[model samples]
Each structure stands twice: as structure tokens, then as C-alpha cells.
Target: MKTYQEKRHFDKTPEPPWRDDQDKGQHRFVVQKHQAAHLHYDFRLEIGGVLQSWAVPKGPPLKPGVRRLAIKVEDHPVDYIDFAGEIPQGEYGAGSVEIWDKGEFDLKRESTDIVEFSLRGKKLSGSYALIHTADKNWLFIRRKEV
Candidate 1:
């Protein structure tokens, strides 16, 4: 099976969703940016056909029980990997975008309540999981090292 980046060629086409060359497939990746808030990172993973985004606040936690507040955003095109320029002034996410961490992930366990995956990223090296809460929001947590 091809990875998300490999399945979708962002180089040949750099259009957003709804384009003929666009891909609406699910994907998961991270983007490092020098934003207005002291240069934090953005970790986004695709789920339910939407890109579940999180601002990390301090990047991925190194230990378990570390819950990060993740803010869900609009579903971005799978071709977003090709985006590496400025978001332009007056635009949302107005900052420099760079591929921070990206690769195929294995869904070790998944359900409406919990989802776990082994994340392979340049900045993050460990297994990560997201559990749904009663409020309908999800809690992003790092799995304990075995």
C-alpha cells in the first residue's frame, strides 16, 4: 500500500480540494511553522475524512498522561504536503509552512471511543493515541514506552 504522500502526488498538482487533480483521501502529517506565537508546531492527523488539527502548544509530549489541547480545523486537501510558502498576509495560518514530520502510520486500535497509531516523525518519535471524551472532543495522548 502506498503512503498518503506517495498515493497522492502533490508535486504534479498543487491545487486545493474540489479540483480535478485534487485528492480527498485521508492523511496524517505535521507542519512546523514560525507563527505569531513564538514558533510552535502544528500536528494534524486525518480522521473521519477530515484533518484533525492540534496546535501542540508545546509540541508532542514525551511522556504519557500528557494531554494536549487540539483544535480541529477544516479538512485540508491531501496535497497540502506541497505547500511550503507563506500563507500570505490577511490569510488564515499566515506563516511559513514546512514539512516537519510525515509518514505512514498504523492504526493499532481504532473505535468511536479510542484510536491509536504508531507515529513516525522527525520531531516526534513514539506511539500516539487519541481518545474520545464525553464532550465529543478528543484527547491526544502519547502511549507509554514499553
Candidate 2:
């Protein structure tokens, strides 16, 4: 996997996150200010040849039984980790960008094809899991003790 610093050149273009072929194994966590209540932070991971994304409304709750909505977004390139600046006016996600948290992860378990891993993030702190629902779809949930 390419380190976040190695993908700097791909950031020069404004194309979709998956535009260039150099985006393989890329992941990004984005904190956006929507036109609604509360700020949202997006957690995305590169897996199965696509960018698996989730929108945590409360920035990934820290307790059990607290489920945050993980809305999937367009597949973004792995280089997005280094993206921190204004997204320009009138754009779809027009807001300031910041690299909140990032690092490599390891899959701890998987049964019935569902894979789980320990997550390390800037705003989100805890162990998380990713379950593959379909060929191109997946669900991200944090691990909570019962």
C-alpha cells in the first residue's frame, strides 16, 4: 500500500476521487459541514477495489447501543488523506478539508464473509468492523461490549 505522502501528485486534479489509476488502496476520512444540523465526519476505506465509505453523523459514537448512520459515498481515491483545504464555492461538498485521523488497520475476524477490524482515527476512537453485504456494498459498525 502506498503511504499517504506518496499520493501527493494525484491531488492536483479535481476529478472524481477514483479518476486516476494511481488511487489503488487509497482511503480517506472527511469531516464536512452540511447545510443541516450537526457536523458529519466521513470514514472511508479502500477494499475489494473500491472506496468503502460511511457518514457518521455524530462522528462515530463512543458507547455501545449507539448506532450512527454510515451513508456510503462515491468511491474516493486513497490520496484523499492528504486533502485539506477549501473545496471551492458552489461545489457539491463545499467545505474546508482536514486530515483528521489515518493509519493502517488489521482485520481481526470474519465469518460468513463478514470482516472486522480495529479502527484508529482522529475523531473516531475504538475497534470497528466491516461486513460485506453485497458484491460492491458493505456495512461499517463499531464494536461495543455487551
Q: Give the candidate number with the greatest TM-score.
A: 1
lDDT of 1: 0.59
lDDT string for model 2 (1-146, tens) is 23222433335534235445655543333443332233577666656455555655656555654655556556555555455665554454655555566665665675754656666565565677656666544556677854
* lDDT (Cα, 0-100) at 1 in candidate 2: 28
lDDT of each: 0.59, 0.54
Q: Which pairs of residues collide in candidate 1? A: none
Using lDDT as the measure, the top candidate is 1
Task: For each candidate, give its TM-score against the true structure.
Answer: 0.67, 0.62
- For candidate 1, write residues 1-146 as lDDT tens digits: 12333334444433233233544454456655536435666666655554555565556666776876544334554555455666554444555666666765666887867778887666666788877765535677887878
Query: lDDT score, residue 135, model 2?
Result: 59
TM-score of 1: 0.67
